[model samples]
Target: MPEVVFPLDSTRSFTDQSLVGHNRWHPDIPAQVHVRPGDSFRVHAREWFDGAIRNDDSADDIRDAPLNSVHVLSGPIAVEGARPGDLLIVDILDVGPIPQEDSGPLAGQGWGYTGIFATQNGGGFLTEQFPDAYKVVWDFSGQVATSRHVPHVSFPGLVHPGLMGTAPSADLLSRWNAREGALIATDPDRVPPLALPPQPDSAILGTLSGSEFDRVAAEAARTAPPRENGGNQDIKNLSKGTRVFYPVFVDGANLSLGDLHFSQGDGEITFCGAIEMGGFIDLHVDLIRGGMDTYGVAENAIFMPGTTDPRFEQWLAFSGTSVTLDGEQRYLDSHLSYQRACLHAIDYLTTFGWTPEQAYMILGAAPIEGRLSGVVDIPNSCATVYLPTSIFDVDIRPSAAGPVRIDPGQGVPRSSF
Candidate 1:
């Protein structure tokens, strides 16, 4: 099948009914177009937050933008032959920032930004330590990204779509909402509050005609976390040459893509991410009949770019155990523990001839990986930060210090771990 280009209208491609918002995914949203199995296409996606941000943006910019408007997605491109219980295989052919001539205000051309969301807003991995919102404007050129915000640090761009998924069936949507609603109710006051149901006003951002399902689906579609439908999993290595298999729960397997990033670390350590940029993705869509039954993936699975062989050189490792330095529990959450570990790694690198700000940039920009080393130990989950030593020119050692307390409920500890 020949490749098809989307949004067909160039003017509305960047900002129009095609862009989906309201943190919810609904099957009712009309498909922008339909393509047959084995067909290929190029999708243009806007930056997260619908380009409300700019390279010159500040914390105030992030503060003012509607927190609910995120992960601006591109489609419900119905795959002709796809059906529920099958696997929608998306082969990433190419990904890059939309060039300046074609891109609107959000174009990628020696410009982009990475950010740390405000803790009060309830997002980001390391929210406790970096409470205030921060922005780092980056310049991209010659396939590399550099920033005055993070002087002396630069790296090649490794572009990828941050959120990719198919529309969930009405039943799957109900189950996801019920489960997440209950989880958030347990801690309503948590930073980046849990219960982020779709708001009726969400339709204002796009063309959804305020259908009841649209509102509920939008509420359920918060793009902050990755779900079985594959919303916002920030896996950095899922670029070209990788094939992502998402379980189809609805007819046509309506697929969408957005939240494009020029680069990101393994965990997207910062709440926002590396060099968020508006871009185009060339992809091939295929289907596996009865793939869900064959693979047993309740959600989605990805075949990495390369075989199981390692990609980076020996990494400088740092471990973060669940118990904070003050001997308080961190709720035994692997994600929170991993954030704690990454913060510790950032803190340790401060001694290696870099400031805290530079360390934060390195963590996000470099090809670092965060791994869950162990989570079975009762009351203590451990995660590790693996920094590819080759990315840096100077050698550094493990800090004499240890993991610090991150859970604000536990109160700030006196000593740095």
Candidate 2:
């Protein structure tokens, strides 16, 4: 075991931890832990919700989830001697569900959850089709996850961190706030809002209080979306053995991480997609000393993905063009095309006795592949989603025999707006 630099007790609230971490991104949030280059350490991360989500059947928690306090990250662990313009190299040595103990109230205690947010709250990619909140609980045995809500399916967990990044400098943070705030101002009343802005409510900056805490809280950036600083990229490919280079903006290269997922597909189609978990990650950190400028790595993280991801040779694919469900055509929109492809998959799955919600959960939690198949095809771009046929208990391939129906047990728990 690496040195337990930041230990967490699963039973306690995230704020009650010995060395507290922040929920928002700000350089001023003091680093509670420090390490030198070439250090191998262990970090215990709370689930993004800090245990606000549960392991039960009800979707009430998902419907009324606290949107303000989120992505409760584990650090601003200052790397000694790390300076601006340096590239911070982080090697994800290992990651998985909560260590040792299993079977508890939390999400990652031998189980985890995948959720679809109601459109009124945190809407997802296909929120138009799924306006209600839904929840699916999956049990972990070894490395595979099996959900009782959507039965007759099981797949290997592609455990990884969904949020990891360094603290943003004051100038960089200002730019983030300016752009995101402007976007929000455009649609301030939009349900689920265009983008989350800095709110003093539920802002948890480590140790700071009084007027200083209020000042930083009002200016800090939310951890909802990925930015130039690599806040919440949610890339499932960043598993063990992956080496990531993050451009250092602040002194000490204050890096923080959390929102661990046992498995997630590309895009994480559902809002609370992925098998959300509280877990421990083994990391080895080193500095690249002026490598940011040397390599022309200006922004965002560049990572060499690990080679040990789950392998699948055969896939049942679905493709969709850039057209709305209501028959309106959009030009060269890959995001819209991918949404269509996912909807096509969900419709196809319903023929095999799975609900649209069940199918959506599978696409979010499984190791499904989503790709841009065509972008240069004039007015319409084409996107594709591929599902590993082996993950299902029955042969999902198209045949003269037609789709085989799998019993969807109990169905997904739902809560409507």
Error of 1 at 76 (Å): 0.7
The lDDT of model 1 is 0.69
Residue-wise C-alpha lDDT for candidate 1, range 1-417, written one tens digit per residue:
235456323345344443443345776666766888888888877777766776563556655556666666777788997888998889988887774433245635446777766766654666666666677777777567776666545566677888888888888777877888898889987767865765555432334564655555455556567888888887777787788888898999988888877878887777675778777888888999999988797666655562322356578888888866567787677876777788788878765546565577678766677789998987888999888775554445444574322211211111111
**How do the predictions measure up, each by TM-score?**
0.85, 0.99
| Alpha carbon lDDT of each predicted model | 0.69, 0.92
In model 1, where do residues sit more than 4 Å from their true spots?
1-4, 7-14, 17-23, 100-104, 204-207, 210-220, 306-314, 329-333, 376-380, 393-417
RMSD to the true structure for each prediction, in A, is: 6.1, 0.8
What does the lDDT come to for candidate 2?
Answer: 0.92
Question: In candidate 1, what residue range of length 10 has the lowest lDDT sum?
Answer: 408-417
In model 2, the Cα lDDT at residue 70 comes to 92
- Cα error, residue 6 of model 2, in Å, equals 0.6
Report how far residue 110 has shifted in candidate 1, in Å.
Answer: 3.1
lDDT of 2 by residue, 319-402 (tens): 999999899989999999999999999999999999989999999999999999999988999999999999999988889999
